[model samples]
Target: MGEDDDGGREVYGKMRAAAALRQIPRPPPTTFQEDLMEHLPAAIYTLLSCWTRFYQIGKNNHVVWDEAHFGKFGSYYLRREFYFDVHPPLGKMLVGLVGLLSGYNGHFEFKSGDEYKEDVPYVAMRVMLATFGVLMVPLAWYTAKELGFSNRAAHLTTIMVLCDVAWLCISRFILLDSMLLFFTVLTVFCLTRFHTERHDPFSPDWWVWLTFTGISIGCVASVKWVGLFVTALVGVYTLEDLWEKFGDLRMRKRDYINHWLARGLMLIGMPLFIYMMSFKLHFIILNHSGPGDAQMSSLFQANLEGNDFSKNPLEVAYGSKITLKNMGFGGGLLHSHVQTYPVGSQQQQVTCYHYKDDNNNWRVEKPWTLPKVDDAGEIEFLKHGDIVRLQHTPTNRNLHSHNVVAPVSKLNNEVSCYGNATAGDAGDHWQVEIVDDLVFGKREKVPRVRSLTTKLRFRHVLSSCYLVAPNSVLPPWGFKQIEVSCDKQNNPSDPHSHWNVESHWNGRLPVGETKFYKSPFLRDFWHLNVAMMTSNNALVPDADKEDILASSPTDWPWMHLGLRMCGWGDNQTKYYLIGNPAVWWSSTLSLGICVIVIAVYLARMQRGYRDWGVGEWDHFLYVCKIAGLGWFFQYVPFLIMGRVTYIHHYLPTLYFAVLMVGHLFDHFVFKSRRLKDTTKWVIFGIATGIVIGVFWWFRGVAFGIDGPIKEHWGLLWRKSWNIYESH
Candidate 1:
């Protein structure tokens, strides 16, 4: 009976997909309307191809690695689980489908330091993302069309995104960054439909508008948290919708608000609900592990607040709360019962029965966990602060990091035994705590210790939550200490700030490893594109330190790049020149294009109209050309000449360029419907003089010693650029 149902479902799914495929026109893989990929300038294509390859096999799934710590498909799969598994499931599903189609569902273990040789899944994932990449042409084209750009401008926009190395690199990767670009651009396109739609709620386009808007937003959030930024952009559109859709007809504000509310409920609300549901059901599937402990803690507190999980043990035990908080970082508290710390009490520390130590310097020792948990099993909680200990293996073994080979190589006491060829005693480098078995019984809140004395008790686990310690796999950034003790009796302020931590290693635990980036979505590559007097820009000294001293566990978005292949360290070798580098010089170049749009708009805007040439076509074009010079300067250097992504030096070049673009646009729009050529030239001269002459005069501040234009700057560019240099 079950087999029959399964077969029926499979047939139905294929039928649905086939129908979807049939509904759309399948043009041969040919270029239409001057695409970025197909119709791009050859130089642009070459750059994009190189970047796409970088993104495809650069940082995420296709990373270069030391022979001891590399895993390809397994690493990819583990990253999905360790990180949030929202939209990547589709990509994973595609991978699984490709695997099944190729009839290699089982593992074909490779020799040491070998790469996976499968081409089908690679081709499938890359082609799928590539197809989306190609789709970007139409999407950007339609966006320009929505904005009412001329055939020339709209077509150019398509070329820009297509030729863009950022877009190309993302396309080559097997993750959600490119997908996110697709969804966001798609949302903007759908929003254009709303913008162009008339005021009438009864119009046929209303339903279609709502459908596209809602689904696009839904899918946007499904890709990653950054979707919220687009969602906000949508709300901005909603406000503008009143001005665009209703403005032409002179509809009252009330009518505009009411009509949009109705459409918004259908479009915005429904899709958001669906996107959230994806997470909820997934949490239900992954019922055990440390999250259960958190859920129980929340449930226990909820019981105190009136709602108890005891009523339906199934509901209580079955699922975690669907919150972004879960995806963020939160590792429970730490206590020492066996005298792990000074002035410690065993009873106060023994909130949970088991405590395992993954720290090298030995903060806490084990019996660190409870009994094991099965896939669907869950550990129960008696009350808040019930104090459970860890006792489980992680579903995300990829993040388990490397199996420890030499415990002697292990700094301090931390160890993950890399067993011999036999797989026996395979090292204990990492310890995963399961919430299910060790024990969850009620306990009294005590007064001896502040932890137990508190009204709120927590499910403390022995595993190192990112909140407690960073992964030891990557290079260490800034430093921190857990136990900073101050004289409480003499201090009246926060202790951590004033605590005199002995600089020696005597009492401090070994510095835990900072987690290596497991996905392309999160990378610690902040390109310091500082703007200098609009003439030059420079990268910051700590460009490689993406989030070294980040405030929280999640701030280290090392895993945020998700699964991109855009390289590990953000390159910054391009901003040494005085003028603008090329667009590919840095990811920050996207801001440069934005500057161009606003410049064109300001130079000829008619109050709130979309027409770029509303007041004066030639003048607007002139301003646009100047603005284009900035981009030309920006891109030409990077493109024709080989350079890299550096923002600080590039910023000075960009700053004045941006202001000129902006002021030129604003001046033309606000100054008048028609102005004299003399007046235009005067304004242009003033803008140019203040930007250029002033920069040249105070060149030191604007373009430091080794800035783009600096003739022979000192050691400014050579500081803090390498990962191996000790601070």
Candidate 2:
């Protein structure tokens, strides 16, 4: 009886222990382990990057290809000169800040192909970029771990990134791409963390991850518009997360509303605020006028101290010396000189030039006589329907247009300056018609000509055509400025035909609102975004120009092309941007493997053959789906973009591909039930060996080791693998 009681009690105790284990939640890692994992990858990445990125970063001692463009922008920022770029301002601002902190004097011109002076301190800037690049590897690794990959898998992904030649090249230079990549990976990592904490909805940890994800979204997007893809990814993920919460039977109605409110504020509101803040800082810092002033409105330019528009507003009169500006997008000041278009008609070429030269100035005179001051002591303003002659100030020739076809537009009447005996003839006379509403109080019959506010159209009296600035470039004879012609059909609403007086020399009218004009941040933000979009759209390659290193998106997946970042001579120091062939091929093949595995898994499910529990497989699929979406979003969009793209553009996509490969290897090979341990080890070993060996072979290219082009060609006999042949 005593033995039976003892056995029964032992069995009861075992059952109770099992029940307790099922009830308790799986706890997170200890703080010490988390710290070790985070710092270990970071330390390794930093050490590797420092050696590869800084060893001979300044060997060439001259400006690399794109450094000229971005370096000048940094100088402009230090000098407080406003400029425009197709990308957002944060990356350039950061570069400029680093240059400033490093004691760079902002005096270098940084012109294309110009050798940097020995004292330029370009290495400091290169190191700053390298730091950002170094962070990308660890960020990718951390992101993989957050998305459920094991430490080995995460470290493998980091190794793939560190070995990529393209990533190395971009990181070792002074470019915005490295910073962009860093922010993109950081954003993904934050969003992944937020996704992982969804079980504890509305908790402080949940809000922290969500908030940081929003901040990362803003940061990434501020680097380049391409970051919008990551933003879209976050947005979609957020929606899905909230939908999942709504469907949960345990979630109360109030909890659902709270979830929506919290996410809306953090994800949408925070990023928008941060994005606008970047632009606000940009406008505040760049106070003086610079090369990009011509692209802005006259009012905005007037706010700058040194711009020509900052002068006192001039009175409008018949004989006023004025510069007429085409209101069309990217139009310039109406200009003409003694030079004629060499091709068609051969008349003196009339074009719109952006610069402030004497050739761009003209005298507005009445066809009959110069006007006098009115009884109110105000100069007689040029009114609508008044016939006038625009005399070139430097050449003393009248603006003339006839039925002759323009050099750019064969159907339009060519505009030119006539200096012969008929300089003041009726053919030179044009009717000035005001197109804007007169808004400077009532009784402004002759609309008070405000510099940017007033718009006018000049109709040729003889040719019955309206003077217009088409978006065509004139020939070399015309200094390659925008073509000015007269179209037969006049559209009052056409911006190309509208003219604004950019600079006037009347000494009577007082300048208004020069210092008091404070444009709202929202308005400026909108204008800047529009300008960036327009500039990006205009980046198509010219068919007449030959770019030997230009590549197509098709060449990116196969790693078939390379870009020459810089070179001193054929046999001297050179940097060619390309990736390790073995890694690229293997990662691409892994993508194919992912497709096959997903297909097989689905087929097995259809056949009612379950390999894992429903919950576990669902979680695994979620991770893979997010990573696959990231890869697709980063790459497939480039295929449709019409602008000029290069192999460097594929680096972001390559990052996700590496992660995808790591995930597949961990889940399919290491965790597989069917595959033997020996088979898995063999496959892993072969891939690792190829990657490391190929990277070693190409280390010379990334490290800037000087070698002859012929020798490199011999080393890489395959045409597609030869980096020198790409250029």
Query: lDDT for every model?
Result: 0.33, 0.77
Q: What is the C-alpha RMSD of each candidate to the true structure, in Å?
A: 20.0, 8.0
Looking at model 2, residue 241 earns an lDDT score of 68
- RMSD, candidate 1, Å: 20.0
lDDT of 2 by residue, 1-727 (tens): 7655775666766764553343323347669887886778778876876777677787776787788888888898999998888898988999899889778989999876667776677888889878888888778777877777766577677778878877888888778988989988888899888877776777889899999998988888888888888887787777876776655544589989988899889988888888888988888889998877765555566677677665646446765788887777666678998887786667677888766678988887767444432334646677777788888988888899988888888888999988642345677889988787323433245455655556789999988899998667654455557789999987877888988787777666566444454445665677567656755665666677776667889898788877777763665677778888876777788778888888999999899997775355766677777777888888888889977888888887887778788888889776678889889778777767777778888877777757666665434635765455534
> What TM-score, to 2 decimals, does candidate 2 have?
0.84
Clash count in backbone of candidate 2: 0
TM-score of each: 0.43, 0.84
Model 1, position 420: C-alpha lDDT score: 21
Compose the digit string of candidate 1's lDDT tens values, residues 525-583.
Answer: 10000001100111112345564321221211111111111122233111111221122
Query: Ten residues in a row with the worst lDDT in model 2?
Result: 437-446
Stretches of model 2 off by over 4 angstroms after superposition: 1-38, 246-254, 326-360, 367-380, 391-421, 424-447, 453-499, 506-520, 568-571, 675-682, 712-718, 725-727
Q: Model 1 misses residue 276 by how many Å?
A: 0.7
